[model samples]
Target: MDAQEKIAQILQRLETGTCTPQELQWLQDWYDNQPALPMHTFRDEAHKQQLKTGMLQHIHAQLEPPVHVPVVRMRYGWQIAAAVLAGVAGICGWWFLNNWQPRHKMILVQVGTGQQKELLLPDSSRVWLNAGATMEYPQEFSDVRTVKLDGEAFFDIKQDEHHPFEVHTGQINVQVLGTSFDVKAYATLDETQVTVKTGMVKVLHEQKGLDVLSANDQLTFSRSAQQYMKSKVSNQQISEWAGGMISLSQAGFAELALTLENQYGVRIRFNPAEMKQDEYTLRCSKQLTITEVLDLISSIHPVQYDIKDKDITIHRKN
Candidate 1:
């Protein structure tokens, strides 16, 4: 095979979860043969089962050959049961081939409304996406660990000293060697919030070419101000979004309103005076409806609201 075709074969193996160390030489061979080829294109579940463990049998069947082959006897001499299970495993193997073909799946996981999802990346990293959040990644990571995220996600990244993970969101670029962190970058909001939970993070503002973030730090990049602010973080406030709670400590009234609008998909207006405030603190549950939040605000402060269709509202709530 030509260099290109050979490299393509190695890539296919890498993507299909079948590549072995012996194949490393194949990759090097492809590279060595690159002089004769074109430049390049940069590229690239758990179950429990026992007896009545149909899932395992199904998975096993998927690897069986089309033609019948000689089989070994079971140590327990349960040939009858083994035969039945083998047939089931065979059918499963076919089902996997036809329906579950890996064909380079770009897996994206997300959550909406009162839902949440936990995902395990091919690199053994973990991600928890909050409601109205999403993560897009490949079925297998290449030389680099790259992902695109929107809304909010908590990442417990796997330590990879060699290749750091990069998170691309809205207008911010976050890179990390290995750390647990949270990011909130919804388009509806005017700012993207990055909070470092452990280790260090580097936040880059793509527009202005600024990088800001480190261990135990909180960073906010504002679209309106076109500025970056860094401060020692009180992690709890920044990470509340991942817990289905919005805790805005020292958040401006306008910022608070913006967060509410984005999370609930509603536009709210506070009596002009409220918007003029420099800041305010709010701790509200994500599960609460906008009306409930407003009601709570009304009880605590001299506030009233004109709710209309749960879509838009004029509020005097403090």
Candidate 2:
């Protein structure tokens, strides 16, 4: 059989899942080798639109279940090859316009201290950016969907099995097909944390797979030690900040101070170093003012605080 007939048979087998791994690899190699059509070559807007529609229709048909059709003989191998390559070029051109073009320009979302924001990505995925967080994403996703995050955010990714979603945070990467998760990776903090709420995610550090997390799973990577810890957490408790709630469980004074600072946009100072070691468990709504929250903290612990403008000083009570 000629190359065109062989390729058509292989494609049919691929659709039916009967193609061998080697055959699949061969097809991929062939596609990768095909020359891409230059965008400048399109003569007019109408011509470009026509080609896009045809390519999209062809792609959609391939994705659907196979239908029986009689094979038509072609006289010249070169003619059949040219026709196939032209279709491939049209597909490439469509993708270039829809995906690659938007990536040249990125959109940035930055949440200042004590300010939180919500974002809707090009793929309709939702993101809740926490205080002092920054996220950068393309105007549209290409073959791979990726976003860069600094600080913290909660993501509810739209499902797309063909294109996986990835979040890049400093040294670590969180990857998923479709899932809800929270990531905290402050540059000043020694640890980076990822908490999964639904579906599954793969955590990678320096291109190496560190762990796979399912619903309620949490992964903490220590920057100083270059080690990671994985554990289970209450999924409902994850990303409580998104709901305007601050929840802590047996958290130390240092951590509490950090949380308060981020939530209230204040600088906290401890009078004594020993106070940093103090631990407490608490939950409070963001609706309460910083003073009220501190009062509650004082009631629970033997401490007093002085607030002056945006600065707070905490001291142990005698």
Candidate 3:
């Protein structure tokens, strides 16, 4: 087999726990033989940031207790395995995206933290997701091109008048014939929002029935609003997060706190949950300083926060 194909097989073997100790030794030796590549050097640029976000997770997996150790140790080999896996994963991602012809009807798309992923559905529709997002679909489009999403996703749907595309987000459902839209349905966010960039969409709240939204229309449902509020959205306001942007409308302090906690990999808690009702807007993307985001929110609402290591606490301005 070719070098790339061989590496791919080895990586799969490793993931499936089928590689023998001797095989692992050879794999490790392969990696150790090559000069170490700085881990940070692999950070994907701009559109490829999603790959960088999950680097830590992959690294952790490397340290996982091995199923077995080889009787003969290859000097300076473990690093080689890591390097090989990295190369294979990069190749696999590219191959998967460019040459996607899987026999399965449904394909699953998963992205790691600080990671963003984009997929072209079986129906020729496109979907982009923010950090920590996942999407699952049939390998092939049977009767419908429906997908289940957790976290957030921006879709550029292909025009299919016969079989419309539908996205199920636990509590709500968004359906479109041929429309471009974005959906943020994280439970942490009191409200779920779907902004239509093009065409039209039908937003159905199992609790509230059908809400139709046209192009440039944004439908926001919050814990307080309880009903769909249709509003005009600035061009490019939604789907910007896929480009490393953070866009939140009518966002509360509680939500902001959670985002900060997620971004920095820290924890920030508020004394009274109600205090999070203070609404604000934030933009922290593209070389923007994180401190600016924190300071901006603090200016609007009088709040006190205590930083205990990576954990933070916020209390009312008392």
Q: Give the TM-scores of the predictions, in the order they appear.
A: 0.61, 0.67, 0.61
The worst-scoring run of ten residues by lDDT in candidate 1 lies at 39-48
Cα TM-score of candidate 1: 0.61
Q: Model 3: runs farther than 4 Å from truth?
A: 1-106, 207-209, 223-226, 272-274
Task: Give the candidate number with the greatest TM-score.
Answer: 2
* Candidate 1 total steric clashes: 4
lDDT of 2 by residue, 1-318 (tens): 544445656655644545444544454466667576566646587877776565435434433325574333223434433444455445445444644456647998889877889999999999999888889999868768999998889999999999999999996999999999999887766778999999999999998999999999999898889999998998778988899888876666766887788888899998547696577887889889999999999998999988899989998988
Top candidate when judged by lDDT against the true structure: 2
Candidate 3, residues 1-318: lDDT per residue as tens digits?
544455556656665545444555565555556554444443356534555334324434544546574343334446654554555444434534433334234667777655677787777788898766678787766445678887788999999888878888866889889989999777666777789988899988773556889878888877556666788988678777878877776677766765665455567777656585577677767345445666666776786666777777777776
Q: Arrange candidates, best lDDT first.
A: 2, 3, 1
Local accuracy by lDDT, each model: 0.65, 0.78, 0.68
In model 3, residue pairs whose N, Cα or C atoms come closer than 3 Å (at least 3 residues apart or on different chains), thus clashing, are: 31-80, 32-80, 104-139, 105-138, 105-139, 105-140, 106-137, 106-138, 106-139
Better of 1 and 2 by TM-score: 2
> What stretches of model 1 exceed 4 Å from their correct place?
1-104, 207-209, 252-278, 286-289, 299-303
* Stretches of candidate 2 exceeding 4 Å from the true structure: 1-101, 271-273
